[model samples]
Target chain A: MTVDTAPDTQSQIHWFLIGMRGLFSLPAIILMLSFVGFAAFTAEANIPVDQVMFMTGMVWALPAKVILVGSMLSGAHVATAFIAVTLSSVRMMPMVAALIPEIRDRRTPTWLLLIISHFVAITAWVFAMEKVRDVPRYGRVAFFAGFGITLTVTNIILVGLVYGAVSSFPPIVSGCLFFLTPVYFLTSIWISARHRVIYWALGIGLALGYLFAVIAPEYDILLAGIIGGTLAWWGEKRLRQKEAGQ
Target chain B: MSFDGVWPYIYIAIAGWLATDIWRWAGVIAGKRIDENYETLNWVRAVATALVAAVIAKLIFFPTGALENSPLWLRLGSILFGALCFFIGGRFRQPLGIAAAIAFLAAGLALIGL
Candidate 1:
């Protein structure tokens, strides 16, 4: 049976439909909110009280916020904290590379590009890739603008709430919110995998990283990603070649 | 605690935001010339995805703070249960169900004290 490939116009219409489908999905909304809540809490705990509110409003990721706040809390020099936070953000380079093709257009303005660059965090990037991939290239900017604005507003509000309500909130509730950030990430990865070896890589990587961290706390993430990623790449290549030969 | 002023924080936040934006702009410039299905890009995507996966797995399995305090078996069980949920959810093409599974596993762990 020949598969029916719809015309490009029809396909574009279908893409918009899928985008709308994801727009109202519960997981999409929760994942978006959880990312903001985690960033807010991290900022609150680590950032100086003065910086906490503002960073939560702007800084996109928890790791960068953690580094920024942690360094400042330790009374490190401002330059030192900046350097630390920037170093933590080195991972963003690859993430940006992966996301750019999904959003960029020939006519896209430089200033708009600047705003997008500033606004695209890891959570936003992943959401854009998964939810907006099928969106017509011409419509992606609007989709991103809509999605990014919602996330930004949600983050600002959540940070404000956490900042103002921390004293009254139960410990478990706050903890759960924090916990959901990683949980959401883990579940998303688990759901998105199309290859079996990727699963093996994640499983082995976690075990090795955790054990090594117990022995040497520093470099756990570096070791895990480098070692696990390399192994998965190699294994996947070999598996694909074997299938081709068959 | 003395650094209670907001100006310094705003300056830092603005600076951080700008610094991160640099990478995004560069990606946009570079993306125009690159082929998405190119083998090199595919490998890059794989590596990036794997790195993220490694980090997420470490967070769930090793954990910290309240999660670290929870019993080891509970953590492992919750993750396994969550993975199973992810599997079932994906099989049926339901992302929300997978998220629900994770939330359920975490809440269950918290309530059971293990």
Candidate 2:
């Protein structure tokens, strides 16, 4: 597994092996740590561990999983949960759209691409997008699938173990576990922010989230996100126009 | 209409799995048609970022689980401290920032007699 031979043979399995090697990558390790946090969260929320495992593999995205659990705990209606998860998961669209073409060519099947798309959340997306360019077109899907399947299965097992183990842990331990996730997201989002507008969106979203939680707790995430994001985008557009005029 | 065993899984399947996967399905369908750098993609990115930020805010300010055990100050302070570290340490310090946050939280929880 430690060997990195050249692509004399472009077998899908060879590329898949290369992808599986990312199991030890920094992003994968960080993701596992985050899932440990998520597992602790689900345990604290009193969600069944099996269900947490299910959601981990099925929902796939951390944010969407959090929203689902949050919505459930907050007693939001099912429809509301659906909508929030949908909105949160919309981020995957651009990632999938961007990566599919890079990895796919005339030989790739739509069904296979669809299967691969399930693994296109943040960590895998970042990893695949960064590495796929080096992969031959025929093997990119296998490479991504190898990484994706390994990552997902590893996380599902991690969450299950953590959820079961968190019960015996002290409050301080669980508290620290809970603390890892938000910090991870905040720093990662800040670091990965591509443009100035994202900062505006983040600030506005945080501020408006607090306000909406007070006024309309169930809809806080939705309302704050739409209004704040729109405002940020609109502000950026206006600023660009003003600069153009000047 | 119930909040019992297995029901939540069903809801999650529909609301969580279906809701999330639809976007990926759409992306695969639309991948060939749209440029990744299309202008509207920026707005989509903004909204997505905002949504994720909103989720983070909710987790910090109004968590429902064991995280609620800690005081609001600890929750708020640790995040601020982490962000501070992130900025000061420059790029490639995300691990440092996260480690700082976990330490802050653990120390805060211990000091407060949790």
Give the DockQ (2 decimals) of all models.
0.40, 0.57
- lDDT tens per residue, model 1, B1-114: 336666566556644665455556776565555645655555545555655665565666666544566666665665566667665664553455445645665577667754
Q: What is model 2's DockQ versus the real complex?
A: 0.57
**lDDT by residue (tens digit), candidate 2, A135-165:** 7677777899999999999999888877877
What docking grade applies to model 1?
acceptable
TM for chain B in all models? 0.64, 0.74
Q: What is the interface RMSD of candidate 2, in Å?
A: 3.7
Q: Which candidate should be chosen as best, given lDDT against the real structure?
A: 2
Worst 10 residues of 1 chain A by lDDT: A1-10
Question: Candidate 2 — what's its lDDT?
Answer: 0.79
With a 3 Å backbone cut-off (N, CA, C), the pairs that clash in candidate 2 are: none
Residue A220, model 1: lDDT of: 58
Ten residues in sequence with the least summed lDDT for candidate 1 chain B = B93-102
Q: Candidate 2 — which residues are off by over 4 angstroms?
A: A1-18, A40-51, A63-109, A122-144, A244-246, B1-12, B30-32
The C-alpha stretches of model 1 lying farther than 4 A from their native spots are A1-24, A32-50, A109-111, A193-219, B89-114
